[model samples]
Target: MKQNLLLFSIGIWLFSCQPGAETGSTQISEESIKTHIEVLSSDDFQGRKPFTEGEIKTVNYLVDRFKQYGLEPGNGDSYIQEVPLVELTAMPSETMTIEGNGQKVELKVLEDFVAYTEKVVEKTSLNSSELVFAGYGVVAPEYNWNDYEGLDVKGKTVVVLVNDPGFASGDSTFFKGETMTYYGRWTYKYEEAARQGAAGCLIIHETVPAGYGWSVVRNSWSGASLYLDQTGGSYQPDVLGWITRDAAIKIFEASKVDMKNYAVKSRSEDFNALSLGLSASVTVSNEINRDKSQNVIAKIAGSEAPEEYVIYSAHWDHLGIGQEIDGDSIYNGAHDNASGIATMLGIAEAIANMEKPKRTVVFLAVTAEEQGLLGSKHYAQNPVYRPAKSVANINMDGITAWGPMKDLTVVGYGQSELEDIAEDIAKGQGRYIIPDPEPGKGYFFRSDHFQFAKVGIPALYASGGYEHMTKGVDYVDSLNKVYLTSQYHRPQDEYNPETWTFDGMKLDGELLMEVGMRVANSAEWPTWKEGSEFKSIRENSMK
Candidate 1:
């Protein structure tokens, strides 16, 4: 009787340990996620900075995890995709001299202005370059607006305002009305200036419209900046930078233009680019370094349509060691990305244990995301699986740590059908979907998913909901505000396993798994929404 009882107990334990045995559903292991986060965010990883020892450890760790999960190599016979990058550390002059209307104004670095050069040269100088106030510096034909209309800015410096007219005027008919479009992005301003053959671009930064303080701009752009190698040739402005509102006011005063009047007038479609009658003279010295980073790629090939793929992505790099703050130098990006990578591992493990999917599921851990999404951008441009063959891309960036919530926030909500799928999955999990809380920040274009989206692949980027289960909405709101103000991109973003909660992160991982599984099993290919900016790109790729 004792021997029979022992045998029966052993059998029951084995059954419970099997995947899909618990409640007839396959669940991601919370223990596995905890271990992954603790290890990835540990100080020994040195913040996982690209091209450093930290990056080497991070890539190895991810590759080992993928191998342990029984995933095949995503990039032909290799688990790594090399990303060639050029690191440019610009050392600008102490003072930027601006002369206008028989007056000279010197702007201080870090305090009054922040600037850099992307010219990839040892030394670059702007010797009395003509400065033109280009009013937002946008030329969007769709909006019937062109700030550079009938203006030739070649070899000149263009100064533009941050955000768009809709944000400034709060007019619904302007450009998405308070919700910043791509044109509102600072990157767009620089790119537009470069397209118009400008030698330099400076964005006037207002905290409200720019979404962050001047300190963020200083900290982010002051140090080493990396860009994908464009040895073949790329159009980039000779100088790119930002000026504080005070500095802009000073310049306007020197130029004899009412700064407030010009700001108000810029909102109108009839606004024209005004020559500031100012000349800028500054020298930029660069210390250039070339290195190779990598994107760790793994895959679970489909049994049937092996050519088609569904991608799961997360960036594994952070702002590495920098100027010490409060005796701490390492920016251990725990919530920024360690949580996302942990979630991706959990999903990978769950998928590995399931039956073969009908479409290939690729797990990609990209590098250099903090340095402008370089790894993902390279993959999107030179993909292992063609964009036309990919079903969808689901990216996990920073996941909420404040516990489970009642809703999920979808970034770029209406741009693709992937959101509909994610919405249904969230609904099944007893949660609803909400658009991004801060739409003017353009969070959708700020992640790795944007790279895939640009290549015509429908992508989904969502965050843990704002309404917490126990803490409620007010608590969640306060927590978000605190995080943005105190912890984001700072050395204080360390991992404290004792205080962290994986409940919401786990739920989000499960939802992503469900969406990916459903898309993989179905024959339908997710596409951009009918009127989405990416719709034409998708249609053309499919053709």
Candidate 2:
């Protein structure tokens, strides 16, 4: 009888150890997240920048952490994927001359607009290309509207406005309406121009429609612009740039059309192509140097299905040492992306500690996000895993430094079934999902995940709620205003534990882990929404 009891006890113990048996341990801990953020965003990291000493330290730290977690190197024999980059500083032409209506007007270079060239050659010029007013400069067959239909702009410089007409009207049906569609993006405009064989493309900037002021364009475009080496190998375009609305008005006036009339006409489909009867001449000098950066990648392969993959991404680079502001230097970028990297590391640790997932999970800390999402772009173009087999990319960027919230904000909602998984996870914790309030800003296109979306992978980036507890929307809006005016991209951005509430960071991290866990286990695969442009690409990739 004693022997029989011993056998039964052994059987019970084995049953308790079976896979999927409940263990009431927290998946990820708040302490780990706090420690990571504290260390990463601390004054010591020196604002982790690419192509600098900081980048070396940052990458090494990530690799070490991955090693500690027993994650295998994602790349062959190494965790870093090299990216070729070219830094260009286009010395401004003293003046831009517009000739039309028997009048000559010279516009000041930086005051009127900012322009650059991809031509690596020392000298580049746009010699008297005729100016064509291309309404919004968009060509979409599905929308049955083609801005280039009435005019041939083969060698002409096209002047177009930023964003789409639907933006001004806030009509959801209009070009995907209030939410900026890929059609409304500035990148699309430039690419379309290049594809159309246009000599030049200049978008007129307005704060509201562009979702940012001219200063942002000036500051962002002031530095180097990185492009893929295979992208025409330096024969991309002689001119791709932006001009202020005031300069556009000057051009309109020179064309003998009322500036207000053209502004109003900019919104309507009936707005026809107008020959400004003008020509523009610009001569620019280029300083080009090619360099290479790297993306740090680490992976935890699944046992049941190692081929299938899930990815978590965060940019590992930020603005290096820059001009001093308010007596402080070093655009620390602690909140901008250090928080993201920390969150990514924290999540990786959580997944590593848990029972092995059914599908592989990759942790990608990309570089050059501040330089126009180059690192992620390269990865998407040359993925370690088949993007088709990759289930989804859960991207974290610029996570909240402020405290926790009752809600989580998804940048692109209603665009994927992945959101349903997110909602379920949030609902389990009595949290809710909210669409980005400023959809017009195209927040979806601003981060690393955008590269994944461009190539058909379903990607999601969620941020803590901006709504405040004590002072409500006004207070939150005030803080945002301050960040926009003073901190963003400035040296004033530094980590402040006293001011920032990391509880929100922990909450966000936990929620993301939950979402990733759900996706990692499910036999189901997510897809782009029915009408999304990427749906076909995803479907084809799946096949």
Candidate 3:
């Protein structure tokens, strides 16, 4: 999308008032970004997972940095914001019993299936629960689709597909086509099942739609699962899990149901729920621990309108020590988010060193984002700076490592006016703004920025890795492929000084600093674009 030159001119004049501010961005150098990433992604931090020693180390490091930089604690004299959470480590039966229609099959745990529950209890189980095939498990009224319109799954188990109906339907008008909406997310499916009073919800996982392999599911679900302490009696399914496509096919065959036919029918709006004529029984013993994780928040107070704010956010958590693979166990989230945290820190330091903007500028390092964006979600619900006062949120999830690129990949592009600002910044740096290369992967909703977006705060999540400065797009793609194939969410994602470069991150950090500074200084607030789902949210909240 081309930026309106008129808005670009206005933005230029708006931010040009910050005297010597361009030099502030230059202070975000490669050395600073590399130092932060190296320390955060090191094995000594133990993966930076919440509710562990890693959490303590990670949060303390952030707090210490903020103090050293002479920034104020964002949370009322305390840099730490406690996010209450419950960790449930489930020991499920080795096999799940699936039987009916004179046939029976045992689904192996961590192989054919992976299951766990978030209901903070010592034990939760589904006993002989009748199985029902629920298409997508969505009830999006705006789309006029309800997979459970006339079905009652109370005390039963639901079998839903990985993505929404538009996964491969190629109908752009339908559910945003291949770009997965919140309805397509597995988190949404489990929430919908619990809303329908179902005892269990199992999403059938396939590589393309689920966006990862079964190994990811096995490793993620094998460890202790964390949930924002649902102390107010919010209900969750007794059994929430995923079954490999092969396992789902096997179970469907045993129930005498044609899996292919059901999958085909599920893509249509007229499709209805069908009972699989099978009963699923699984028992899981849970070890529950209620704990608190810290969200490190530090701020540079405004020289003028201090109540209004511009925010920078990044999640500081990753999969702790997990299923050992390739003779390694630590899931050092270098690219997954250590890079993001590093970038945010670099930007924060640069901005703090310069003259303050009109509105406060905050840097937030949140916890449990890998768990499910829980820390940001909690902060959004209980905020020190109200959403209405927040001018914008600039989030960094992962930074490019294959050197600077010509294209700035904006995740969730066209959602808000923040993209327009990003466009101006990118053009100034001899780069162009482009939409996410893999929008179907739902990178926007997968990050902590979505939490801020949900509450009407315009957020920017953009990076430059699509078209490398010297090597071009194909070279960047190859490196990205290698990381996704081997190191993504795995132990191999460690800092290798010989291979990793911080020049690109330095490029991004500088631009991100300008984005926040512009928003903080400008009197005009950014808003969700006309067709965005979040438009009405800001409208209702401001009222």
Candidate 4:
């Protein structure tokens, strides 16, 4: 009953905000952010890999800290939300082979492409099934395009090229112009193929088109892949993987087709799935395991509208012990996500020390984000509060350890009114907002915010700026380019305060707090932009 009254009181407080005056300035301290980052990025955590001992240690630490700050459990009586996961590693029978019209080509997994099975079976295979070259493998009724039009893809392997045609054509008018929509993502392609009853799926990889090289895809997917246990979920393709362009050319030539013409024809809207006139056969054996992960949740209830909430999220998992490089076996993820988790905890501390918000606020440290956004997906599918009552999601993915930049880069910038709120808060501190330069990378769909977006919640996953002050923008860009190439997802990602700038991270945390706090105190809920695919969902949920 006390909790019920407190929630009702917070609702009352929102109407009492003094009009025509700047609400009192938030007092977020730099010392708090510094302290949180220091401990999270420390070596004792062993990179906080989910399903490992590190995860237990990390969750205990966060929950203990939340207690110290007087925060309540987000879920009744507990601070953890259990996320069930199953890890399956796909091992091919041998090398995957392609044969068509008296010609044969052999491709090795991990060298030419990385393939994995999503099926729960012990073994699966495809033999002599015809291949179909599906352009992007997208079936958008709204776009009046369907790659599977009149085609029975059952028991057939569908080959697709990465990204949308608009990416290469520089036609923003085609599909949100330069920005990558969900159609451009490889996961969606694979899902669509599986839904279409295709036997197998292979995505053709090009550096620019895929936003990364074949090596990245190989490294990320080659490890143990996790999926939610859907006892009766749609069947996954028998074979799933990617192939190099040269390898794709070999398959095309074997089919007695002009590789150049096939490539050019795929760029047109009228293009449909074509018979590759070849068959791909692969046998995959799986090592399956089941485990339960947890999402650590802490809350600061408001003085008034407790049912309404403002959420802040960060992923706590990183690549576990992997191939050793120079004897550093751990990928500490100090920068990839340790920094992000640290910022989330810091923001929680800052809020805990402030006057009570008008609405409840939740600080969520989710798991399995590195393994395809599992933790956040579960949360979105099973939210603590109805999606309509939640105000917004403020996510911190990769925070800058470099000193503060003059600009803040908002990923998926134009999708939400939250960006306007972010800009308002950023400008208040003499900083400016910038859109991501590499939108074609499909970064918006790559993080935890995407799970929330799928459920019609407005989310913002903004990271540190690559544009530096002392160094030129080009120099900053070069540094990121190098990180993306050598250090990302590699064992080389260790915490080195010497090379990092906490000033920027601290500033970013403050801006995030400001945004969340402002929304929590207001009666308004954010809306998606007009014409956005998610807009209608948000509108319906609000009603």
* Strongest candidate by lDDT: 3
lDDT of 1 by residue, 59-126 (tens): 99999999998999888899999999999898988889999799999999889988897777888777
Pull out the clashing pairs in model 4: 9-304, 10-303, 10-304, 10-305, 11-304, 11-305, 172-177, 401-501, 402-501, 404-504
Question: lDDT per residue, candidate 3, 1-543, as tens digits?
Answer: 444522544444555555533444346868878899999999999999887899899998999999998999999999989999998888998999998999889999999999898887777888999999998899876577899999999999999998888788978788778888778888889888989999999999999998988998998888677888876454678889999999998988887667677667999878989899999999888888888988999999988889998989999999889889999999999898999999998888787778777789999999999888999988998887999888899999989877888988888776888877777778889999888878889888888989998899888889897899988989998998999789988899889899889889988888888788877877777888755657777888888
TM, every model? 0.90, 0.90, 0.89, 0.89
> What are the per-model C-alpha RMSD values against the true structure?
9.0, 8.5, 3.4, 6.3
* Worst window of 10 by summed lDDT in candidate 3: 1-10
Q: Where does candidate 2 stray beyond 4 Å?
A: 1-26, 223-231, 234-236, 256-260, 263-266, 468-482
lDDT of 4 by residue, 427-509 (tens): 77777677887888899999999888878898988855767756758877887887877888877776675786677777888
lDDT, candidate 2, equals 0.78
lDDT of 2 by residue, 1-543 (tens): 123211223222332334543323556566666677666655566777777777888888889989998889998779999988777778868888999789898988778877787666667778998888887888876566788886788888989888876676646676677788777889878878776778888999999889988888887766567655453542345787889988988888888765576655866778787678899998878778787888999998887778999899999888878777888667788778888988888889888888888888899999999888989999998999899889889999987766666677888766776666666556656666778888889988899988998888988888666665344566667777888788888877777767877777777888888667766766667778756657777888878
The CA lDDT at 499 in model 1 is 68
Candidate 3 deviant stretches above 4 angstroms? 1-26, 51-53, 99-105, 250-260, 319-332
| lDDT (CA) per prediction | 0.85, 0.78, 0.86, 0.80
